[model samples]
Target: MGGRGAEICCASIPRVWYPGMMVLVRWDMPDGLKHIVKEKMVEVEKYDETGSIYIHFFPNDEVRVVVSIYPGYSTAHPIRHYGKPENINP
Candidate 1:
């Protein structure tokens, strides 16, 4: 792995479902941006047997969700805002 990157490996992800599911994505950037995003799940129209889910990171500590309904294909979905560490209230 080289250059700036962000990753949420399988070790960091859990198999069980929890309320308010959130994951900390490891982001390695020169500017040192925070990486955390809420877990989202949605259904998409499956045109074929191949499909995938994607998580997109942003500079402002935000994330966008995308899904592929079929292989070798891509589509755009509405962006969603997740809570940061500071966004939480006591």
Candidate 2:
């Protein structure tokens, strides 16, 4: 997800259509690069007429964890999106 700011919106979508589904891990950057996961079989939609699913995750020590969604499907892999620990604001 890298265009729309629908982080909370995407995460809130129910898993009804995606039953027994799991998130998938696409690639993880090394050498202190940010961790990026690629989710499959997810229904991504733009917010209103000027929004899209653009998600960006920060380092663990930088900000809270978040789940983002993008519009796409896996061709040769299983349909599952990645999952990360969310942070609790105190």
Leading candidate by lDDT: 1
lDDT of 1 at 13: 26
Clashing pairs in 1: none
Task: List model 1 lDDT by residue over 1-90, tens digit each.
Answer: 112334434443233334455443344444446644344343222222233444556554545333333221112322223333111111
C-alpha lDDT values of all predictions:
0.35, 0.31
Model 2: residues >4 Å from true position, as ranges?
A: 1-25, 32-50, 61-90
Best by TM-score: 1
Give the clash total for candidate 1.
0
lDDT of 1: 0.35
- Please give the clash total of every predicted structure, in order: 0, 13
* lDDT (Cα, tens digit) per residue for candidate 2, span 1-90: 222223233334333333343333233344456665543332332122222223344344222222223232322112123444332222
